[model samples]
Target: MTLAASDRGVVEPSGLMAHYEPRRPVDLGATLGHHRRGAGDPCFAVEGGSFWLTLRTVAGTATLRLSPTPSGVRAEAWGDGAGEALHSVPELLGEGDDWSELDVSAHPLLSDSAHRNPGLRLSRTGRVLDALAPAVIEQRITSVEAFRAWRVLVARHGEEAPGPGPARLRVSPTAAAWKRIPSWEWHRAGVDPGRAATVIRAAGVAAGLERTAVASRGGTDVWRRLRSVVGVGEWTAAETAQRAHGDPDAVSFGDYHLASTVGWALCGEPVDDDALAELLEPWRGQRQRVVRLVLASGFRPPRRGPRMTIQDHRTY
Candidate 1:
């Protein structure tokens, strides 16, 4: 469905409005999953069924408010980049996602999930830098630790979102801004050197990285380019691809808990990466989608031990 742009002098002062009609119901939760950093993410806010996102665009920082309408989703924006943000709203809402060939009829578990969440769509931000920074911070760390680091770093460096929105709505730092972050600040945010260096290197090539969002490049090529960076690897590339391109096949191989979780969900027993890969081989290009289904299947591995201990790198 094509996005319709209109100048509506309604609730928003900017009068900038855009809307899209989806072929199927749009699941706002699944589409906006990548935007929320944590319960306290300063860059994103959701209240009263309206979703707000602050992003840095080529034009400038823009804050977008998305609300559901009877037909589809409506978007309003305020800031210098309002037009750019509105232009990209369709992609962000998964307009380009096509899963028509996926056949889950034979697999009871996946078929059940597909039936349960028919509106689920993989969202694409088309902004690699935004996804990469958080993925880098999450490397080899607990989610709590990574979230804390993200909150601290973004709050310190990100700019306030334009308009009369909540004070907590802020735009993530530009790639240049990220590259300029000092070692001391990284330390303060509890980000280790390796991850910090990776982010910095990525920032240096931010423009090039954005090209990976092009659909024609394919997720494999994007993964290869992302992994060419010093500290980025299979896991980081997959995580980035999933968000930036809505890549269905980008399964995070080296994630600390994913293999076991997927294994148990699919086979009723914890399995290593190899086993998980073998089990998911049938879905090849749709592996990530299968993983998402498993996660949403309400099937979890039996907890036999304590959770991974949270480590505080700030003290180091």
Candidate 2:
């Protein structure tokens, strides 16, 4: 299935295009979750089954409109970074991900989930800064609060997405722009000093951090580089790696709820990070993949307590 400009609307002549056919079935929406914050994320928008991604690249900012094809996915982009965006379509869609080493047969639950969602793939954006900024905001906070802070920051500092994409689309702030964000504005956006300071520090060394994406070093090496930043720890590095490089083994060790969730899904009871690690040791190199499958399995742990309350830092 080819995607022509006329299928959605008139395609701009200045835009670049690319297509990818995955070896396995592909789910475009699920694959692109790394770039989206929530339903109305300013940086990414979903119209029906199609995705509009506003990203900042080495070349500049670009907005990509991607639609799933029966064979794979098609990408269209406009702006200074159009070529870079088009070139990244395959990586963004998980076309090159190799799963032959993953054997779900050892665990019945995993096997069932893998069978149920064969199209599941780990997308790699190959841009560490993009993932790191948001991960910092998410540190020790509820997802709703983190998302709200992200939306506020992006809306205030990000540039309008170029081309004929959705009006709501905007490119995330550049590293310099991020560094320039005033402390007062950070407060207004409900961002605490810790997360805000981490983001600022990351922006200061954005280039060095971005290099980890294309480094010949292994995932462990990349994690080490990410962790060199003071506030970036196990959970933050794992979350960044998961999206920036499709790091299969980057288990979010310090996430507030992941250990319990994984334990409940696999053992029908909550467990600590140590127990979860031991349980997932057999699939050491593919732990993230296993976790994703479990999440897709619709096996929610029984709710035993009140959910984390959304704190309004802005009020303070």
Candidate 3:
């Protein structure tokens, strides 16, 4: 990777002479913007200037190390095959020719937020299966407990990330491994049997579903197909679609928070899915982008009567 142009006496055509940094995939959640408490994966980090970055499942976290290079950047990590995953980040983040031509505007979420990142690329990840599998396990449970349950299960049964650090990142259970989890294990994980069963069933054909999704209508259509699976619903499908393909149109069908977000952003009050769709009609193909921006921009309606009800099937 050589720069065709020169900057501040820096000669052109430098072999990958570019600034690089480690941007956590989970934190890069909102169009590579902010970081959040990763569900159960210890995937977080920041380091010195480096084009190359390394990541690892160290101590129950996705430990990432970014380093700068005279001509470029490099990174590395250890855990649950972190090396292989790191290699794919460039693809997942997407590359840019001119820093300004990223066309992030079309993606309303990334509009003003698109910093003049010198070079950016998306990492190709299949972690969606891992994240969503358990997320569904708690279906209507409290996120507080849900996240805790996820941390426990992932930290326990899942493989440690392949890296040089302590137990940071953990490999999400494989479909086969998920299948082996006993009923009692799920209970301890705070997951109800029904949702757990759904996750197991979905995992059984996850690969097939992913293939069908990309092969069929890309990510959006993939969610539709996934929703067709038994036990899979709109909220689950939307959540899955968002990560499955980094889709920008996946408006969670049952997102309790999103409707209000969109409603508050588009209108001056809270709303429902129908109204949310109507308000988002202008964005059409990019409703999700619009929604993300509204959320990131801090345009949500005031807390309307406490948040949505949190139910737990595990107790049932």
Candidate 4:
């Protein structure tokens, strides 16, 4: 890969460029931004009119920059895995996502959301371990806690991305690197022992998990494989499957807020997981799509209680 320095003193890579025009309308940011651990995620960024992502691909670590164009999305990749990164752009941008199964006409809110955001589509990252690690960290914790732990750990342990992209951007640690993270580091990052153990266990068997993602048909196998990890469960597996394989039916069944969110939006009251399941029965094959549409509809359930307090494991 070729490198160049901008007059502003930031190094940037002038690497291979590729463009993909999706058959359906695509919202570049909404589709890819789902992978971001948080707004301040070290591995994902939005700067200078482009989206930058750093990930470990089959070939190696790569930094990818995506910019929206009139017709589609344009991409530039750097590092040993540049070609593979560029090649994965279409899938990353939801080129294979088919929205035909979503029956929005079942509700006016769903119909309106579908009409308003025709460009919204589910993205497939195809890196199961990368997706699973964060999901494990997020298990049973508030998103604020989970995102913070992910950011702190990745920034400290991950390698700097190979590109003239953002200086602070880093790819997630490799499976071995993840396994090597000491227990103290997890505590320092505000991660509890259970979540930490789960992540390490998943890393130890990363290859099998990734294979399950590849071998998955409609996401069942991937769900089973992910849940096989001790700390992983229905919610965590669904979260991983949604990103790693673009499984449209991967509803987060055990999420603290999801059932209430769906219940309030669809039933005019809060509901538990059972009620949420019953309400979503009409869209069995595409429950996640319905969830996404509900989220995009901007109907957050009213705060019925105090927000979850952030837990700091370092004190323990």
Candidate 5:
């Protein structure tokens, strides 16, 4: 298999080197881009035309770098959990995502999008707290504010990554570390008390939450468990489920903009959350996939209000 010249220079242990050949082409960016908290996120990076990710795994910390090759994807990992990290490459790249249930023929736009971007698929990280914490930080805030808060808090508290990744990359903070973040630090990071408290509460029961991902009780149970956490609601749980379980149907129900965006793309009119639900019912089991198609279709509703401004809770 032909690989980038840069892949040749990496000398790693047998356990740290691995590759995944997807049956069909996969769009790494479209599938995994949501995991990036922001452009400056210390836990993720896209440099030298490759993707870098650092995670706190069950075994230990790991840094993984993925590069696409003609045959498939080449992955190299470092740290105690390198083997575990390498093993997760396929799932992380959407290898297990089943699109057989998706029938987009009912909607011409969705049909065209499905035909256009066959490589798009939802990714599963299989780490609950990792997904939930960032989602909580993002609640009720502009993306700019949430992303900035994540960047600051992670860069300040997260550990150094194990691999020879880009200088900016770091491992995401562990549950304990997240729980231990002081109030002043959260304030300094511009994460309001409500969001900060939610993250801390969830981190306290992170093991239980992570277990829900591997449980066979189904996505409904996973959603219920996630929502049980104080302050975690439909939006946060759906966002976490999308990444942690690669749940195909976990639509972001309460998102401020999702209903409107999906509405405009599907029916040429903006819709409220209730209307969006009814509109998307036709694709119940693959709603998130349809959402992805709508987003990728480049259709946007007319702006009816000013863009939400970035806010600093510290200043308030």
Candidate 6:
């Protein structure tokens, strides 16, 4: 995977180590659980690359180090914002953030989740729009399918991360780059043409969409504005909020499985969206964060129904 970087650099596989503890910035549960979902963790899959990062929740600190090789960015993070800077690359990829100023406890959702994953916290700071385009494309699909398609699409069209190694180092493509993707390529990534069109349309207005998330009022305003795009909806916006804005209230309401997951885990019966929302309401503004805690606590409902089927649009 050829990586693209604003800076020229590289890394030799054997040379890599770093520590991190992003102050009230990282969603640590996402880092440890989401399998490349969180930016704090190194994208160490590329050959000839190594990484190290640590979390210190009580202190609100993170550190970072990036060793650029001929191929990609070899990174190490330690201190208060190390993990933050690394995971925050999406900002550089057309996502933006003013992380220096944020208040964690000011939001009830964050205050509680910080207790849940003390080392990880999401302030009113982050790039909410970066995830919107791809996440909108992921609507109604199984996560396995969504991630697979995302990985494939990104690997194929995105440029490499600028650093060092023979590894595939690519950052997510710019808005212009994504808009230029061919129809056949989207099909190969298991994406339908309809979703592809939505993503392409979104990419064209990517900067404007991102701006909506950080506007003065609240995350809701951003959510409302993004849905103005043809293919975007509550579910898609919810997914984006979880990653982009760190919105605690952005519960994934229309999910086919989440209601069941929450019901079985907490109430032991499959509930509908209303029921799940009722159960989660006490957490209100931080509903998403509470859900994250519930998920992270390692509680899963006992298997009952048929498993979700995986569909590959490429074969058609």
RMSD in Å for model 4: 6.2
The global C-alpha lDDT for each of the candidates, from Candidate 1 onward, is 0.82, 0.83, 0.53, 0.83, 0.84, 0.56
Candidate 4, 28: how far from true, in Å?
1.2
Per lDDT, the best of the predicted structures is: 5
Give per-residue CA lDDT, model 3, range 132-174, as digits (tens).
6854854676667777777777667776554444335555676
Q: Who is ahead in TM-score, 2 or 5?
A: 5
On the 0 to 100 scale, the lDDT of residue 287 in model 5 is: 87
| 312 Cα displacement, candidate 4 (Å) | 1.6
Give the per-residue lDDT digits (tens) of candidate 1, residues 84-167: 787777667766566787887888888898888777778878789999999999999999999899989999998989986777
- Model 4 residue runs over 4 Å out of place are 1-15, 215-218
**Which whole-number lDDT from 0 to 100 does residue 111 have in model 3?**
63
How does candidate 5 fare on TM-score?
0.93
lDDT score at residue 2, model 4, on the 0-100 scale? 24
- Stretches of model 3 off by over 4 angstroms after superposition: 1-40, 43-73, 79-83, 94-124, 212-220, 309-316
lDDT by residue for model 2 over 179-224, one digit each (tens)?
Answer: 9999999999999988889999999999998888773213878989
Q: How many angstroms is residue 18 displaced in model 1 relative to the true structure, after the best TM-score fit?
A: 2.4
TM-score of each: 0.93, 0.93, 0.71, 0.93, 0.93, 0.68
Q: Name the TM-score of candidate 1.
A: 0.93
Model 4, position 146, has a per-residue lDDT of 89
lDDT tens readout by residue for model 5, 256-287: 89998898888898899999999999888888
lDDT (Cα, 0-100) at 178 in candidate 2: 96
Scanning candidate 3 in windows of ten residues, the lowest lDDT window is 8-17
Clash count, one per candidate: 0, 0, 57, 3, 0, 52
Candidate 6, residue 15: how far the Cα is off, in Å = 20
